[model samples]
Target: MRYGCFLSEPQGPDAIAGLRDQIAQAVADGFTSAWLSNIFGLDAITALTAAGVQAPPIELGTAVVPTYPRHPAVLAQQAMTANAALGGRFALGIGLSHKMVIENMFGYSFERPGRHMKEYLDILIPASRGEQVDYQGETLKANVRLTAPGAGFPVLVAALGPRMLKLAGTVADGTVLWMTGPKTVAEHVAPTITAAAAEAGRQAPRIVCALPISVTDDPAATVERANEIFKIYGQLPSYRAMLDREGAAGPGDVAIVGDEDTVLARLEELKRAGVTDFVGSVFANRERTRSLLIGAAKG
Candidate 1:
């Protein structure tokens, strides 16, 4: 399994131009990918392409781009364009963001999100493959063909539960998870998705796990800070269910926070538990966390 990291807008000059140096740092540190979460600030794809133009050879992925707001055709065109710009180094990860975010923040009804996702992917996957998708579905319609030269890269879905897992298995390249622990990946996420992929005669799907990482001498203090920063994740229903399945008290409970030895062991557990890619969200002692993860990966 390859190690990766999430690069947010750090508090400095690179914040506005995008963290190209950080991306280079991650690459130099032996990370396979540098992830960007699609949130309020700069658009992930735009930022990724801009950075990838200058940064060395390292994969770039969005933890998720919300599908509720953008149509599949628009997303396909955007992905194709960005992938072309990055010479197909971009992996498009999209999802139906949590109901609270979709309903309350975007003002879109989060009714039957699974079905909506199915409809969205019906057009998205084909469109990404350079096909002319003249498709109509219950929630979406796309009549566009990608004329872009680059073969579009992989599409990883941010899936948590069974339906989405099955969707990722049959259609998407893989599943990208957040706040999901080793236990859930071993017992729930991997099994369900793998079974679906098997039944469909597809290869076993990739499981890209995202979780907080802190290589700290003061583990307790680090966990406390993780709880403070990531508490909101536990309140989201899907994440709450995942936490409950992992028998976790909250987001911090599942986070991989410890000294280097403990963190390395936990990362091994994740790899053994079926995580194909580990995206570390460094919450404290950033360089140490990255160095330890890279060292563990080398080992």
Candidate 2:
């Protein structure tokens, strides 16, 4: 499995420059790819587009950009532009962000999220491929043709549930998972998505598994810190469902925290669970965790 790192956002006046430095450092550390999350901060795609230029050719991807805010046509245009800016090394990860954020914060209806995503993909996939899209679905409608420089970059969805996993495998290129454990991936995610992809005659799907990792002397303390840091994920329904599937009480339960050997064993387990890529969100003992991951990338 390919190993990658989740690039943390640096908060400052020159945050973009800081992000570029981080990407360059990741490249220096021998990381193959780096991911940025799209939270209530700088836009991930825009930031990556700007930061990735100075960094030498390491793959950059958005952990996810919410679909409710940007229309698919607009997103395709932006993603293509960003991909071009990054020398065609950008992966667009899109998701139906949680109901709380969509409804409460964004004031958008979160009804029938699965159907919304399916319709979103229906337009997005073809549009990203530079096709003339003239499709109308219940949740979305697009009638436009896009002429973009970076055509055909892979699109992955933050899919956890069966319907979304099916959509990810059959329609999109793959699935990008966060806060999910190996057991869930082996039993539920891998099987469901793989079957859907086979039925659709598509190539094997890329399952990119991302989890909090720390190579620490105090694993228990790290777990406690992780629980506090990522407590919000335990409440998000999509992530909550995956946590439940893994039989984890919370996000901390699934975090890979321990000595080097222990962390490597956990990564091996994820690889056995059919993860094509592993992105480490180093929460503690950052340098050591990244060292291990960099070695794993070379292996």
lDDT of 2 by residue, 1-299 (tens): 98888989999899999999999988988878899999999999999999999777899998999999999999999999999888889999999989889999999999999999999999999999899999989879999989999988999999999999999999988999999999999999999999999999999999999999999999889999999999999998889999999999988999999999999999999999999999999988977888899899888
Candidate 1 residue-wise lDDT, 217-283, digit = tens = 9888888899999999989898999999999998889999998889988989999999999998988
Best by lDDT: 2
Cand. 2 TM to true fold:
0.98
Candidate 1 regions exceeding 4 Å error are 11-18
Clashes of each: 0, 0
Q: List the candidates' TM-scores in order.
A: 0.96, 0.98
Sliding window of 10 residues with minimal summed lDDT for model 1: 9-18
Task: Mark the regions of model 2 whose C-alpha exceeds 4 Å error after superposition.
Answer: none
Error of 2 at 113 (Å): 0.1
